[model samples]
Target chain A: MKMKCRQFFEEFGVTRMIAVGFFLAIAIAVPVLHLNTLTLYSQALTRMAMNGVLVLTMVPIMVCGAGMNFALPIGIICGLIGGLISMNMNLQGFTGFFASILFSLPFSLVMGYLYGLLMNRVKGSEMMIATYVGFAVISAMCIVWLFVPIDNLVLRMQMGRGLRKDVVLTDFWAGILDDLCPVTIGGLTIPLGTFLFLFLMCFLVYLYMHSKTGIMMRAAGQNPGLAAANGINVDRMRIWGITLSTVLGAIGILVYAQSYGFMQFYESPKMMSFSAVAAVLLGGASNKRASIFNVIFGVMVFQGILTLSMPVANVLLPESNISDIVRMIISNGIILYALGKGSGKK
Target chain B: MKTIKQFFSENLVVIFFALLCLGAYLIAGQAPYVVVSDLINRVMRNSILVLALIIPIMAGMGLNFGIVVGAMSAQAAIILITHWRMTGMAGIVVALLVCTVISVICGYLLGMLFNKTRGQEMITGMIAGYFGNGIYLLIFLVLFGTVIPFWDEELSIRSGIGIKDTLKMIDGMKGAMDNVWKLQLSQVLIAVFVLYTLYMAYCIVKRGRENRSAVKISVIKWLIWGAALAAVLLIPSVSAVVTRCKIPMITLFFVILVSVLCQFITSTKLGQDFRSVGMDIGIAEASGINVNRIRILATIFSTVIASWGQLAFLQNMGTFSTYTAQQNVGTFSIAALLVGGASIDKATVRQAFIGVVLFQLLFLLAPSAGTKIFNDTQVGEYFRTVISNGVIAVALVLHALNKNRKKAAQADSI
Candidate 1:
């Protein structure tokens, strides 16, 4: 019994245990605080589905050993540019949403290729370099957003010369996926379309992971020397992994914007990467390994905590943004824990 | 020509930034006096923070993004001191003492964290900063009035659960160092030149008594420096601007003191341990040095200095956005350090000084230059942000490339 308990603790990880404990605590608090359990559940579901794909972007990169995609903003920017172009052409509804995804593909691919090459060069220092690369791209886009010649009246800022900070997708495809076939039961609403879309992406990624190319990539990441000795082209596999991750990131942001009903430009995407990273880590993924289940579980728990904590914290300490503080603590705390664990090895 | 090429390649980042600053300054078209005075103030405010980043880098921990933690501890101390209504130099001293204690604890923990993360210290430190910010907010925002029993009419929000977002330093504490011994920039420069000449003469005399043949060379160097100082002082326009600009002598003294301490520490036994550990961790362990302890010590030194630097920055600013003041401390400092040509593995006081000046110069000119060029000040702001972040990215890439090249060369030699 003692050995089994030790094995359980070892396998489950202390960080994941703590995260699960926190999630359960928050889950219990929702009802004990006399908040609407149904409403919170619905919100949590919506959030989980919304952020699910973004969290999913972590798996391929981690498996192929590029570290956490801290340069997520690179793909995020590509997505934003695509979304903007779609809007510029005055596309709307499902057509607009899909068009945006299609538009972002090329940008993400090219950027991902270059990013992969950069990652190949930096090897051991990928995470740190990715972070600054994300930062540089975002800040550079801050200037580009000012001059991008996108003459869309709706997307352009009112009384100024640049894009609006928040571009509302209401007239376009806001909630096109989310409201497609939401299920209702006992006053709880589930965003079925969004979930379906999320699951589709996950399934595709799952299939890819089981493919020959994916196996080679994993082998390359696990032991580059051995992979190279076997003539597996380790560097090429890494680039493919990175490119796939970037492409998913581009799609993920579009999915997010549709549900959230706002394409937040400039600095908003800055912290998105951190939250996704923390979510995956919370779901029991390590620095060099992750999976589809990690994505699904992590997003649900993380977004659930976020959705539930707001109402609970507000009731407990009104007027203060204690929820945001909780978020920063939880997300960053999980990340720090994972990092301190050092590539999930003993 | 080869030497020139080597110099350019070595100092590429610095030269790029210097030229960018020049272009921005010309485009911005601000008066020299105004720009210089503003530059002086900014340099005074930010240089110490930039200097705080050196020890950890020297110890081979990369840029210590955990300095944000140090900045937070300093802010905590400052808040406490302000609440206690301590004023002037006494307040500053009390705050420094309190900050040192707080940051020592923070730094020790951060150092342990760095050890745990090892190769990924940079990202860990960045994430840790965010984590620390959350804890910081929890203390000030939630626990302050409710759990800790604190009440201040001016400092607290109306709901009274937490401190307000921005805290104005009580008048006496504001400019506590800057106002103590303010002097004209020209006066300060001349005084520095005179002191330098005296120090050189002392060196020459000592060397002469030791029968050193290098004494004449030293004398000539000292005379040339003196002549250069005199020549600069004689320039009418330069003198006008320098004389008009006020140097906060006490603040400048603090900057010099920190730089000298940094230089002095690098010559010590502990600093040698840091150098050895940085150069080769495996060899350092084999050589019987407590590599972990030295790393911890380096982190502690950096955190302590950063706390003091934050105290100086806050006192000079007079008012600070309580929650947000420390947010950019790490990024700006690291950016400035990198701008000065320091890498992840190497840095110097000279690089810190040059980086701070050039960074502040570009910062001052960016907005005006942006308005001139793009007709939008925000463009310039974004441009600078991009430049700072891009500079760090470029530096990292270059460092990585250089490391790979070295590794490949070693493999070939083998």
Candidate 2:
């Protein structure tokens, strides 16, 4: 029994245990301290559904031996472009959201192809290069956002030619998923539509991972040399993984924007990758390995702490804005811990 | 002919930067005097911070993105010094002292962490920097006035719980070193004489014949460099810019001192250990060198020097946004280094200096040039960021390509 306990702690990192404990503490304290635990739970569940696909994007790239897709913003940017254009064409309701997804598909495929080519060239230093590539692309897009000539009154800035920093979608696609069959019990609301969509994605990803192409991807990731010797064409496998990840990333942002009720431009998508990367990591994923279970588990724990910490800290600390600080600490701290764990052995 | 081709290939990035700067200069059409003065001031302001990246690169820890943590240490010190109402040079000294202690501890912890994450040191350091920034923000925004009990009315917000978002350095530490003994040619000559006397005194203490030759060679090199610098200063156009800019003699001297020290350290036993580990860790370990310890030392040295560099930078600027000033330190520094044509696996003091001058020159001119061409100065700002970050990405890609080619060649050889 003692040995089993030790093994449990070893296999599930102490940090993950601490994170679980922290989540449980918040869960218990919310009720014991008479805070509105139901609202917090509802908020966390909504966030988990919203952020699920973004976290899921990391697995395909990781499986193919590409590091975390720090350039996730590129795909996010493609989605933003698609969503904005769809709105500009005056599409509304579910058709508008579907059109946006349709529009983003080509851009996502093209961007993913180029990004995959770039990643292939810089094999050993993919993560580092990906980071700067993300920064470069984001900043370059800032110039585009200003000059791209989108003339929609709702989309453009109030007093300038450039696009507005944020465009509200309340009349269009906002809560398209959330409002569909939302099961409300007293003060708590469950967005069944969003949860179902997220699970569908999770199920599809699981199916793909067990498929022949998926096995080839995993084999290529695990041992590229051996895979190559067995005529696997590792580069093609990795590129496919990247392309799929990018496609999902594009879809992820569309889902996020609908539920978020706004399409944010310029620097909004800049730090989106970090939060997703941290979530997947907190779920027990590493630089070279991850899974769907890790994705779901990580997003819930991460978003739960983010939702609960504000109320909990308000009751405890009261004066300062401790929630934002706690959010920053948790996200950045988890990433640092994840990066450090795979060190020294390689 | 092949040598010429090799030279062109090696310096291709430098040529591109030179041509780009020339184009921007022609487009902006700024007066020579204005451009030169701006360049002089910018170089003096940014050189030390860029120099802070040298040691870690020498030790092969990639770009040292955690230098932002070092900048944060300096900011923490500056905040406290302001709280205590210390003014002038004394304030600067206290801040420097405090920063040194804080940065050494932070650097050691960061170094140990970096040691574990060896091959991916760049990204690891970048993440660690964000993590440190979180803690730094918490301390300043949440704990400083509430838990730590700083009582400066001016530095705190109205709520008395957090430091003000921005603080002015004019009342205390601004240009503290720059204003010290603000020099002329007479001071320069006197400093040169004093340095010569010190060198002579050191020579006498070096009683060994072998030591004498090395000392003599170094002194000769130093004299030649001194002559070249003096000649440059005497140029009429350069002198006009220098005089107009009021370039701080002390700051220039500090830059020179760091350059010399960095060069000297690389010739020492510890430096040898760093180089060996940097080249190949397995071989270094087989040779009985403590690779991890040397890497840590390199990180500590870089972080400490970066803290001092940040102090110099903030003091010169006379004001800073407490939260944002340190955030861009690593990004800007790494971008500048790459712009100078340094690669991920190699860097030098010369590259650091050259990169700073070229990068700052482009930064100084691009906005005006953009306004001239595109009728929008914001384009220039965005362009500079894209160019700098794009340069880093290109350099990384090239390095990766080189590695792949080398591996392929090795396989072919086998």
Candidate 3:
């Protein structure tokens, strides 16, 4: 009886630990909540909506068995370039949104294709190489950013420098889609427009993956050699998987930028991999599998923790990024623990 | 004539690195001589730390990304020691003890992680470092100041509950070791390097003599080298460097210990178990080896080393960019090791030294040189960062290509 009890505790201990973390967070938040419940609630919701799509992007890659998209840095850079071009072209309103998505697709596709090819060849070391390629691409893009001409006087550097790292998404399709159906209730504003678009994307992804091609992808992920033996072109499947993921990643960042209000560059997209990976991990996604549900749940819970940390601590402690620190610990700790499991069944 | 061709082909990596350096030097523009001197000195100072990355590669695990764990723990120890205001050698000694304990824990964890995922140990370890780095950030940033309530009004920000990014933790505690005997950078570099050389020489000498006494001498040489490395670490300078861009003497000792220990593992029966596990876990198990234990041990060693590396790096920088420190460290460091001519299935200590020197130099010079040549420092900086990433990409692609071809060839043979 005691042994079984010990085993049960060990099995569900992670859930308990997280529950404790939440408990502690609320304990600290009570006083702050009493003072400014209205303000805190709204802020938390805003953070969740902003970070949701980015978290969602981690799903397909995990499903395809490519592990966490540490290579997310690449997709982010592509999205940044895509967004910049759309704004610079002066495609106002819906045209700009479509244009940015259009502009980003080819780059994201090509990058993803190349990344997939490399991952296919590596067979086992995909995660690590994905990270390197991601960094390399970002680094290369940094150089390109300096040289990419910006003839738009408004878009050009203030001091005749190259494109500023943080370009305003205010112009063109800046918040066009985002503002479509924003709902303000109880002083908490929800970006219904973005949430809908994001939801639609998720639904499409879910439906598409439930088809035949997705089954092959899942198969390739589970046992590549077996899939190969069964005459499924594993490499091509991976390429397709990556292409879809990258496309989603491009959109993910766009949703993120529109909601967040600005596009920060250079190192801004650098740690996208870690964050996306972290969120998915929080949702109980592991190295080989994840779901859209995991993406949503993870982002909500993770961002909730992040949003609550600062004010709660600040009511007494004064620093705001305390939540960020906690978020970092939980995300990576989950990843580490997940990875440490001998079978890595998740 | 033969020599020239041999040099060009066989030493292509080195040749390319040298040419790149010269190109960077010309374009790097004029910095203050002192600053330039100081930077190079920093390069030399950190060389030992970088060199410590080699042995694990020799044992075929690629880059020791988890060495950051060891480095970080070492810095933590140093931080606590300095905070307590322990002076001179005593502080160094106690700090080392702390690093050792932290290293053991970190190493054991890394070793176990690597053990399970044997073939992809490098990537696994890289992630391990990133994960650990987050914990490090969380501890230093949030918990230390608020939850734990450790107080030193000087170190804490006006808004309590978080340690400042840069703490003058070692302000007066600087160069507490350098006062023992004045040592120049040349002497320090040369002395540390000679130990590596002597060990190599002893290896060669053992091969030549083939006598039992000669083998004994090799062991003695290792003992002597250990002593020498410790001496180099402890030599007192007139003024100690607190955030001075000098060599991290303490970090070097930790790396050396880890590397030697790794080398020892490879040379012993236990090492054989590790190698067998790497080659074929099933076969190793069948041969009565504890495969799981070996894998676990490998992971632990890697983790401890990583922590040590991180600790050293943090102390030297003396600041924390909580968000991104550990994110790409594994990739960059691994890229550097590869760029230095280390390969996946094969790597060596020499490769580690060469990689660190070349990679760091390129990293240093790229921004300056790229800017001067391209007339934009951002371009240079970006290019450098990208290239480090690119080199790894290229190396990995090459590895994949080679591995596939080799498999194809084997298939054909079969």
Give lDDT tens digits, candidate 2, residues A100-200: 98999999999998899888878888988888888888889989988987756778777757888889999789999988889989878888888898899
| Tens-digit per-residue lDDT, A153-248, candidate 1 | 988888778899999999999999999999999899999999999999999999999999989988998888899999999889999999999999
Worst 10 residues of 2 chain A by lDDT: A337-346
Error of 3 at A142 (Å): 0.9
Top model by lDDT, which number? 1
Docking class of 1: medium
Q: List model 3 lDDT by residue over B89-207, tens digit each.
A: 67656765787788788777777676666666666666666667668777776678667877676666666655566655465345443333344454555675676777677676658
Window of ten residues with lowest summed lDDT in model 3 chain B: B237-246
TM-score of chain A of 3: 0.90
How far residue A242's Cα lies from its native spot in candidate 2, in Å, is: 0.8
CAPRI class of candidate 3? acceptable
Question: Against the true structure, what is model 1's DockQ?
Answer: 0.79
Candidate ranking under TM-score, highest first, comes to: 1, 2, 3
Model 2 chain B poorest ten-residue lDDT run: B181-190
- Which parts of model 1 are misplaced by more than 4 Å? A343-346, B208-220
Expressed as tens digits, the lDDT of each residue in B291-385 for candidate 1 is 88999999999999999899889999999999999998998999999999898999999999999999989999999999999789898899888
Model 1 lDDT, full chain set: 0.91
